[model samples]
Target: MHINPYGEDPVRLALDLINDPPGSASELGRRCAAAGLVIDVPPGAADLAETNRFLAAWLGVVDAPDETARAERLNALLAQAAAYPRLTNHAADGWHLHYRDPDRPLAAALRALISVGTALHLSGRGMHRLGRCAAAGCERPFADLSRTGRQRYCSPACANRDAVRRHRNRTAADHG
Candidate 1:
């Protein structure tokens, strides 16, 4: 089985959606496809609202204080979503397991995919894998798939900015 929904991509998709929300159902479908998720059905008005609510709730899991706390939050979410595992090959590429039924609504599918993907990621990787960017002033959350597991920022640009700021602060302290 291809685990973690292929590493950081699933969480990256979640971050992208959270950072810049889609304005319409079509936009959501487009964004999900762009993020490598195979969307079999397009979303509608209700799907959009449902997706928005789901994402907001999912953010709470990301913002949880600790691993155990995060797991509890995620488990609650999964229980609420209440999907079962099944196999699908929407794109005709190959068979893969889905935690949702084929005919489920778009929002429900997203909830299942995002929640299950998140659980797989955290359990397979590490609890510290998901967190808010450590860069000053950037509150965006990210999933770290780095080999060393020391990533604290969303991107290299943020990391570089934080590093420069730290260096300048240390130099100023020494001079003063």
Candidate 2:
């Protein structure tokens, strides 16, 4: 069965790339493929640099403090990647929805998928679901997919760190 590649996978891939950027186009292609993106192009060095530049811009949207700012930033991305939605079997697993034309290079396809998927994810889930980790000293971006939608940290480690901090404060207050 064809899974929805446009949702969690793309967001996760964006986070992974943002956290640990690829060193080369080949590496970017490899990592993206590992993250469920099907790359058709033999990526060149330029593609890697270009994708990173694009991601930096996208990160601006992720970092936007308000929903209005986020939407404006995302609208710019969507306009840049401009493609009509269509159903296709690009993966050949089965027919599914695509927001891009077929056979585009890895960089272009990523721009479309990541941008649009992020927009959908944020709007469908909640505007507050995407943000930098709330844990002190951790600036990683994350798309919160938690059932309760209250997630603010990038990982369990960060969550635990914040929890410990709060617990320590509470204990100190009690002692005082």
Candidate 3:
């Protein structure tokens, strides 16, 4: 049923924010809008700082050593966000459930969305669906949204680069 909306877009947004953090509150707002989030508060310096703190913790979930540790870290985040789900149709066209209260500040809303979205992603997709890039020298985080759930790099560029590096090494080893 595409029940998650691909982790309901929040996971990808979280990743984007982590990988390339916004330099300013305005930029953050623009990026959130680009990602389809309806920000209730205009992003501010405090929002930027809070989001940074949240991402720092969220990255921990990405780098967790095992499923148990990962769950533990994510649980911490969920507890901090701690909001009851309520249905709303702010757009007035379609109604959907929201994990946070109505008209929350960007930072507070992000806390709920990223935490809850990540929980859904890990549970719905797989515990191993989040990780750092497999490409050597690139430690960026990635959410494995692949149909096969075998993704190893944050982007196609990293994957191709790693493949090329492997091929070159193999060729050199064969000649040596």
Candidate 4:
């Protein structure tokens, strides 16, 4: 089945990239392809640099102090990235909406996808959906795609570690 590529996938991709960034443009391209993105052009050094810059800006949005600040930062990113939507069947998989101009570099296309997807995700879910993990000493970023919208950790390991720490602290307090 054909899913909209501009929604959760891109946001998730952004989160993955942020959490463990690609080492090079080739790695970035490989990761994006693995994430189901169709890369029509080969990624290069410029794409890597641009993608790093874009992710830094996106992290600014994720770490924004409030909804208003987040919205402002996101707006700036959208302005810099997205264009009018167009219909395309680039891979012949099926016709889909593209939020960027055709034949752009991998980095440019990724910027648009991430920006638009993040906007959709935040607005459709909640402005507070994107954030740092609440596990103490592990502040990695995550996109809260959980059904309950109460995710507080970046991964199961982090959550379990934090929970164990809390239990130990409570036990120590009781003994003391």
Q: Rank the candidates by lDDT, best first.
A: 4, 3, 2, 1
* Candidate 1 lDDT: 0.84
Q: Answer with 2 or 4, whichever has the higher TM-score.
A: 4
- Clashes found in each candidate (C-alpha, N, C closer than 3 A): 0, 0, 0, 0
- The positional error of residue 75 in candidate 1, measured at the CA in angstroms, is 0.3
Q: What is the TM-score of each predicted model, taking all chains together?
A: 0.91, 0.91, 0.96, 0.95
lDDT of 2 by residue, 66-171 (tens): 9999999999999999999998877888888888877888889899999888887887777888888999999999989887889889999999999999999999
How many Å off is the CA of 174 in candidate 1? 2.0
**What tens digits encode model 3's per-residue C-alpha lDDT throughout 141-163?**
99998899999999999999999
C-alpha lDDT of candidate 3 relative to the true structure: 0.90
Model 2 clash count equals 0
On lDDT, who's better, 1 or 2? 2
Q: What value does the lDDT take at residue 51 in candidate 3?
A: 94
lDDT of each: 0.84, 0.86, 0.90, 0.91
Over 4 Å off, model 2: 1-5
**Model 4 — which ten-residue stretch has the worst lDDT?**
1-10
| RMSD of every prediction | 2.0, 2.6, 1.3, 2.3
**Number of backbone clashes in candidate 1:** 0
